[model samples]
Target: MSEPLLLEARGVGKSFPGVRALQDMHIELRRGEVLALVGENGAGKSTLMKLLSGIYTPDEGEFFLDGEPLRATGPRHALELGISIIHQEFNLMPDLTVAQNIFIGREPRTGRVFLGERALEAKAAELIDRLHLPLDPKERVGELTVAKQQMVEIAKALSYEPRVLIMDEPTAALNDAEVRVLHDLIRRFRTPDTGVIYISHRMDELKAITDRITVIRDGRYVDTLDTEGTTMPEVISRMVGREIAAGLGPEGVREDREVVLSVRGLTTKDLLRDVSFELREGEILGFAGLMGAGRTEVARALVGADPVESGTVELRGQPVRITTPAEAAKHRIGYLSEDRKHLGLLLEQDVNANIGLSSIRERFQQWGFVRDRAMRARSREIVDTLRIRTPSVDQTAKFLSGGNQQKVVIGKWLVKDCDILIFDEPTRGIDVGAKEEIYRLLNELAAQGKSIIMISSELPEVLRMSHRVVVMSEGRVTGQLDAAEATQESVMHLATLRPETEAVS
Candidate 1:
């Protein structure tokens, strides 16, 4: 009977206040197959994952594993059953070593209480070696790179000898090379007795790694297809329930403009080194590179979030010193960070409050009283402008969908009226619909004479939005190409160029 499949979820449903987050969601995972669950933000992808991982009990239906009824009250119970989940957010203790994190609870006890570090390291090393990971079990997990930390998470999952593994956007934070490494790991983990449920927004990765595609839409199961037979557009149509229009905005056509931002001989300790670039008004400049190629650091340094020990930032024609973010703002420079939850939004605040945060001080009266009416009007304008889908302006930013929260972040910068905006991974966790909206907004802003520096790890987004592309590698600009001249191959070549190999004038 085909072993009754590894796992079967039947008619799962869930709801939140005034929202049916998931409904009649049916999915199955067989041993030796990678089942990819795909949908846009607010399509109930996370809710379904939560249900599968035992973070939430289904309001209606039940799941079966190996033909036996399974009811897990919580994630711990599910983990004990050999169903492991790797969350989008890394859950790790900074002070703990790699071995400690992997064997967090079930540590080897030497006596009745003390941890057996040597034994834990031995076991962790075995798992790491099995994954062909270069991680040192003795090293502190906090000291490792994001990619390495992710590998450790995978090793920890393997330690449980998981029969089914659930991964949520596993490659969102990884670089191109790291993504390649992870793809290989996924293949190795696929066995006749194991299954993997992969969740990701990157369409290309879905085509590359997944075997079966199950698309969900608006909390409902749409359909499933064989990955080899289906196309990206078809999957997108299923998830969105409509023909997704080609990405927003006019393709990069304004290459003949004067420079708006010019950075020469830029250098920061460890973060940036001799980086230089020129950005033109009404043009979207894309910065592309692998993680640790200094993309975030460059954005932070450009917006004065980090101080530069050397280099000059010129606005229009004159040189300027951007010692702080405020100074950068004064120069009409704005930055949207990649770390949205921590650095981008005030989660506890309402959408209106966060939208007006950067300009709240400016909008206040003589006794430092906030002009509530004025702020609300401004927030409303931006909300409508961005087409942010929220219940109301009073809704907490945290309650909004990932894509809407991202719009709130953009609205904050728009309120600041900064002409030069630096967006670091603008569509990082956003859905396809929201991504198009953001792209359109960016295009409109540029058309209105705002210069933009967009730092993206996604090559397609970079290609689609930028007027010119600047490839950064190892803290330096390796090459710059006009949109017409840039291809994935050419851009990647420059993005992966080694710092030591850079030619000097």
Candidate 2:
């Protein structure tokens, strides 16, 4: 009655130093079905993805494709065999055009020497048309927004036209409207002759996109459920092997005090325009907006990560000029960038070094020399506090999971005793369990009188975390709402405010 399995991994196992990444894992992707791979961060979902994509070979187990033995070769070979993967991180080259990035290796050529630019754009245009995307094929990848970059990634993968397509957190950077387009495309792409592996941590997308759900915990096979029949609580319980608390974070409400950070008429060369808001002591002030709505730009300009043409940053009513991130940090303002991998940590360095980065001079160093003992002690304390999963303080930062890496960034700020902190998409690429931990940490920090400005794309997250919400649209603060007034509907309305009318609710 049902289509036969297109691919299966039997008793697959993989391991890395000091970590049993995966063991005794079984997975199946059936043609005509979207298989959802659900797991917590560090649950070996990534490991399993790598194996299926041919980036990594399983130490144990076998893969069968259409009942034929499939030896794990490599990515190119995998694509040749009708298997393709879109990594969680963007794999696009910034300097190249969208068309060039998509058709890099297989570009149309002129006389076997020059790349046929027109032909390349035409082919990319065909793919873009099919997806109903408004993006220009010849536009440089670096110039596009995060959401557009995500679309380019999908376009590139779909170009391969594989029978088995794998997507890891494809909707992580996309907005609600863009996500709808992606879901529609995925539904259309999944035919009886094709199979799809949908790996994501977004709970709302699980049943909406997938037919069957497979749960993996701690690198082991847990259980599988029909997507329509399973509930969120059931899926989560299986992922963590226990009951997780119901709410996003623990209940620790802080009473608002005097304004800690006040901004007036903040303007940037790109995106942000005349933005003004105030963050109070012991408050979690959330910045909510759609893609390219200037939320991140405001956060960056506040911490001097970007130049502000005209703006006033008043810290505790004291007018301060923040011309650089270092100056901001010196003034007790810490910024956690949304692009954590590229901007947050020194990937080649150890976890301890990153944790002690902000206060290296005063706290972890002395007399123009390094203080290894102090650094190690402080790193251990923060790692323990943040629950960073690593073999030791010396573990490389790049090897840590996305959530752990986020914790390290948080640790950097915490070590500096920063009072004004800005967290931009703090939980992006993070699993649900780790997300709750970050929320708990944020709530705890607020309770401890830390003023926070949190920028998030998810409306539910905005409502769940913030005592007050600031909505931005077209580089302007459209509205501000207290916790009691900031419903999803109200936030959406403000986020989509038009330029002609200024609506501050």
Q: Give the TM-score of candidate 1.
A: 0.64
Best by lDDT: 2
> Residue 402 of candidate 1: its Cα lDDT?
87
Candidate 2 local Cα displacement, residue 145, angstroms:
3.9
* Predicted candidate 2 versus true structure: per-residue lDDT over 1-505, tens digit per residue: 7545799989999988767898999998887899999875578888998888789988999888887877759989898888889998888999999999998899887677755788889999999999787689999999999889998998999899989989998886676788899999998898988989998766667868999999998899999899999887677667657532234322333445788888999999866778888888888999987666788888788878899999798999999998899999999999999999999999999999999988999787788899999889989999999999999999999999999999999999999999988999999988899999999999899989899989997666778898888888768888988877666656655765553356685
Cα lDDT listed for each candidate = 0.83, 0.85
In order of appearance, the predictions have TM-scores of 0.64, 0.61
| lDDT for residue 130 in candidate 1, whole number 0-100 | 84
Residue pairs in candidate 1 whose N, alpha carbon or C atoms collide under 3 angstroms:
none
Model 2 earns a TM-score of 0.61
Q: Model 2 segments beyond 4 Å from truth? A: 1-4, 109-115, 126-136, 244-321, 329-505
Ten contiguous residues with the weakest lDDT in model 2: 243-252
Candidate 1 at residue 394, lDDT?
96
RMSD in angstroms, candidate 1? Answer: 7.6
